[model samples]
Target: MTEFMFSLSALCRDSRARRGLAAVLLGCVGLVLPLAAAQAERIKDLASFTGVRENQLIGYGLVVGLDGSGDQVRQTPFTQQSLTNMLSQLGVTVPQGTNMQVKNVAAVMVTTRLPAFAQPGQSLDVVVSSMGNAKSLRGGTLLMTPLKGANGQVYALAQGNLLVGGAGASQGGASVQVNQLNGGIVPDGAIVERGVPTTYAQNGMVRLELNTNDFAVAQNVVSALNRRFGGQTATALNGRTIELRAPTDPQGQLAFLSQVENLNVTLPPARARVVINARTGSVVMNRTVMIDEAAIAYGNLSVTISPQQQVSQPTTPFGGGQTVVTNNTQIEMRSDNGSLKRVSTSANLADVVRALNALGATPQDLLSILQNLKSAGALRADLEVI
Candidate 1:
C-alpha cells in the first residue's frame, strides 16, 4: 500500500485511542465553560450558624500608674473607693473617717470578646474604658480583673499595660488633645479561663446557615455543595439554611467543615437601600434604587432681628440716662436667591448627586428633599434616616 493508505489503516486499527482523545477534549471544554461563568467569593464572606455568635465580656477594673492624669477625686468617688480597697488588700489600714486622695488611679471598665471555641489559656485583646470622670487614661496600667459575660460567668482574666492610641497635655487652663482620652486597647491582655461548649458535628447531620436570607442564594449554595459531594449528601432546608449528611466520624466531619468553609460562593445582590445621615450630610444608595419622574426645588431664607436700647439725656447722654430712655428695633430679611430649578434624578447614584448639587442646596436641604421624595413615592428604595 502507499504511505497514505498505510496511515489510514493504522488509524482504523486504533479506534479506541481516537475515542479517548475526543472524550478528553470534551471534558476540557466543560471545565473551561464553568470556570468562565463561576464567580469567586472570599472565604470569610460566607456561611454562619444561626446561634453561633461572639460573647461580650465586661468587668470593673482599676487603672493605675498614670502620670497625674487620672480621675478627679471629688468628681469620681469610685476612684477613691477602688484605691482604698486596693490598699486594704495590700495589708494597709487607714484610720476611720480619714480622707485619702489618690492622683494616679482611675476606675475603668474592661471589655473583651470571648471568641467562639476559645479554650483555656488563649489570650485575647481587651478594651479599657474610663467609667469614672477620668481626664485621661494615658500611661496607665490595668490591674488584673475578671471579665464576666451577660450570664454572670467569669470567662477571662485581663491584666496588662494599656496601649492608648491617644495623647493629651494640659498645662495651665489650655489643653490639646487627639483621639479619645478615655479608651485604650491592650493586645493579648486577657487569658481565657474557660471554654464555651459549641457543637459542630452532631446527630449525623451538619447544618450550614447563610449570613443573609435569600432563596436564590440558598439554592446556589446547595447546588455547590451537592456538586462537590454528590446530590444525595446535601439538601437545602429553606432560604437560610442547608443540611448535609455528616461523615461517619465527627473528626472527619470537622475536616469536612474545614473544606466546606473554604468553598467559594457568589453572593446574591443585596436589597435596595438608601442610607441618609442628616448630621454628617452623607447619602448612600444601592444600585437597585430607582427614581420616578419628579420635580424638586430648594431655597434658603435668612432673617436678621436686632434690637437696640437708646438712652437720651438732654446733651448729657453719657452723664445721665434717667432723663429719657427709648428702645429701638430693626429687622432685615434676605432670601438666598430663591430661584426654583427643576431637578430630575435617575437610578444612577452620580446622576442623583449631580441633580441635587445643581440647585446649590446645602446638605440639610438635601436631606429634606430626600425625605419629601421618599414620602411622595418617587424614591424607589428603602429610605433609612440616621
Candidate 2:
C-alpha cells in the first residue's frame, strides 16, 4: 500500500512539472496565460469614443399601481395638479377647489440614454425616479411619458411596468425599507420617436479615440490598423485620438473598421498610480506603484479631560459652620510609541502595504502618512485624493 501511495505522488508531481514547462514555453512566445495566472489588467475593460456618446433625455411622468405606497396628495401638490390635468384631457370635469387625496399616484421624472445611431421605433431602457414626496415605488407602473432632450424635442415615449429593486412594509406608523425608495427601471420601455441624424459610414474620414492618453499605445494602434488594412490608412493625431480614412463603399468601411477594433495589440507599461479617498479613508495602489527608500516616524498624542463633582451636607443647618465642597478635575495625556522605519519599495505593491502596516497605523492615519510620503518625494506615483 505504501509503494502504491508513493507512485501516485510521483505521478502528480510529474503532471505539475509538465504543465509548468508548457506554461513557460507559451509565455516565452509572447502568449499570455489565463487570467488566473496572468498579471493585473492595465487597459480599460470598455473604451468609449470621445465624441461618440449618448444623449440624455428627460421627461415628467407619473407612476401608478402602487400598493398604497405612493405619494401623499397633501404633501405633493404637483401630483394632484398633474392628475387633474390628465383627467381633464379625458373629458372628466373636475370642479375647481376640489380636494384630491390620492394615494395610488406618484409624480416621477423619467430619464433615458439615447445611444448613438438609435433609429425611430427602436426600444431603449428608461429609468423612473420619484420627484415627489413618495414613500415607495415598488410594484408600480409608469404612464406613457414623452421624453425630450435638451433641445426641447421629443425623442422617445416611455411606458411600462416598473421594476423597483426594493421592498417596504408599514404597520401602525412603523415601517421598514430594504433598498432605495425612489427609483426604478424598465427594460425596453421607451420607443424612439426621433433620431439625431449624423453621417458615420459615408464620411471622408473616421476618428478613433483611445480611452487613455498614451502616445505609445496610440502609435501602436495606428500601426496595427495600417498594417491590417493598407499603408497610410490611419494616422495618430494625438495621444488620445487617431484619424483614419474610410473606403467609399459603406459596407467595406464597416467591415474594415470592425476588424481594426478587434485586433489584439499589447498594451504599453502603465504608469504608477495611487488613489486615495479621503472621505472613506481608502487608499488603493496599483501594481506599478513604486517608492524610493525613505524613513517615516509619525506618532499621535491624545488628551482627555474628565471632571467630577462632590456634594457636602451643611452642619446643623448652617449653625455658624458651613461645609465646603470642591470640584475634582483630571487631565490625561498619551502618545503612541513609533520608531523611524526605513521602507524601500519598487514596482511591488505588496511590499508597500507591508511597510505601511508595520507602523501600526489605522486607516485614517494611513492617509496622512501617504500624503506626507508623497510630499517628501519618496512616493514615485501619482497621488490623487478624492
What's the lDDT for all of these models? 0.79, 0.80
lDDT of 1 by residue, 98-197 (tens): 6667778899999989988899999999999998877788889999899999989999999999999888777789999999988999899999999888
> Residue by residue across 211-316, what tens digits does model 2's lDDT show?
7788988877777677777889888888987787887787887676676666656566678888989999988887678778777787888999999887776667
Error of 1 at 274 (Å): 0.2
Q: Which stretches of candidate 1 lie above 4 Å from their native place?
A: 1-43, 303-332, 339-347
Q: List CA RMSD, all candidates.
A: 14.8, 8.6
lDDT score for residue 373 of model 2: 89
**TM-score of every candidate:** 0.80, 0.79
| Local lDDT at 248 for model 2 | 75
Error of 2 at 171 (Å): 3.8
Most accurate candidate by lDDT: 2
